[model samples]
Target: MREVTLTHRECVKLIGSPERARYGMVSVDGREPRRLTCLIVGDGDLLIDLDRERPIERPIAGRPIAVEFTHHDQRGNGGWTVTGLGLARPIRDGDKPIPMPYTTLTVGAFETGVRVCIARLTGRRTRPTQI
Candidate 1:
């Protein structure tokens, strides 16, 4: 099994698009549970670093989201689920979108069904990486 580990910063960079959500392709099976890139926006423990030079929203210091991505395979369909702590209400820190805590997201069809989760981490910290 191959695992794509993304740091907190990596997640934010992927979330650069302003469409609320975006479409990222990866070399994986086009079946249910295919790994893909996504942005989980909610009232989760994640935070938006709208203060950065590029200003990318990233997962907070403690919340790390588990992105289970999948696509259509011969057996069934395709989709992805980002599970973690999320928001309970709309989080707007200034003009940017701030995710809440404790939520689950499921995205599919490359555009049709997009799900974003929000979660909080107790004390998890991931180093930022350049995409």
Candidate 2:
């Protein structure tokens, strides 16, 4: 496995495209994993919407966060591991505090690569990690 870092623009481009975007299972420094949908707004802010059943006990905005996942190459020959790390920012809902399950992230860097062979496997899109 190799480490890859993504620039803000690169991060935006990846998340901005619907075809490239996938629901990510994210954890903040080893916290319980949560389902998160990420997108880059036109203004270049990376928005992360969390799926949660309960209110957040504390503010997570400005906290450091990382997302780990596997993505297939265009040809589906191999799986490239990706990890996006950034600082959680806040998104406003017009006078309402940012909801418990939503956050805005300023993507600072990411690490990906060192492809793992999975082409021989069938019935699975990508191997799951124990994030």
Candidate 3:
């Protein structure tokens, strides 16, 4: 379970293209983690289409967030995890909550978030456990 730092190239490789999508762990303002997935698309900029069982009413337009994508090999092979940073508008700028049902809320506490620019990514190599 010892975490290891990965190079830029390694990070990109682990996070394959859109075709090879997997869920990532997302947390805003160090809150609880939620499940989300998206393609690497481009370098340095990460955009997440966040989904929740229920809508959130807190302000998140300009809140700092963290995301982690992980993989574990069941056959004793080494696996890795990637963590990234994000950005958004001022929290108060878009504090108003977005109405639910059929509305697209961007840069708020309900729907989408600003581009998560992960300029640099670190890695965590997973150690296989003995059953």
Candidate 4:
């Protein structure tokens, strides 16, 4: 486990590759991390979407969070993992309301109301290991 500092361009190149799984695990307040769908990967952060497990639960903006993304694809090769710390910011539409993007999955397309959040990386470390 070594810390590899990646430039913005390098981060995009490695993370944007199709070989990487389109999912990440995110945790807040030192709680157990949960799997989140990777919505969009930016130069310094990622847009993640998740549903509230309970009606009254949701991670608020400005909260600290930990994120992890890994590579896993058709080749079945052992992949690397990128872990980082970030802050969560809920996506807002200028005070109008949150916009739940219409996302389509294996089943079909539907506008499922989900909590969209941004994990703005403050620090990151890379792990290169073989299975």
Return the top candidate by TM-score.
3
**lDDT for each candidate structure:** 0.31, 0.42, 0.57, 0.49
**Which parts of model 3 are misplaced by more than 4 Å?**
1-4, 17-20, 50-59, 89-113, 127-131
lDDT of 1 by residue, 1-131 (tens): 22345444444433432333433322111222323434434332222222221222333222223333222234433222222333322234332333322224433222121223343222222233334
Error of 2 at 55 (Å): 8.0
Per candidate, the number of residue pairs that clash is 41, 3, 0, 0
Q: Write the per-residue lDDT of candidate 3 for residues 1-131, one digit (tens) a residue.
A: 45567877777778763333456776777888887554343563444544432333246666776878887777767788888777644323333323312222222242443445565777767665545
Query: Tens digits of per-residue lDDT for model 4 on 9-121?
Result: 55556655643224567777677787765544345455543342232136446677677766544464334556666666664433112343334422111122222343343
lDDT per residue as tens, model 2, 1-131: 33345554554455445433345556654577676544434423344543331222235665666665456667634444445565565555431222322334322111210111111111123433433
Candidate 4 regions exceeding 4 Å error are 1-8, 19-21, 52-56, 72-78, 94-131
Q: Whose TM-score is higher: candidate 2's or candidate 4's? A: 4
TM-score of each: 0.26, 0.45, 0.61, 0.55
Candidate 4 local Cα displacement, residue 20, angstroms:
9.5
The ten-residue window of minimal lDDT in model 4 covers 105-114
Cα displacement (angstroms), candidate 2, residue 4, comes to 9.0
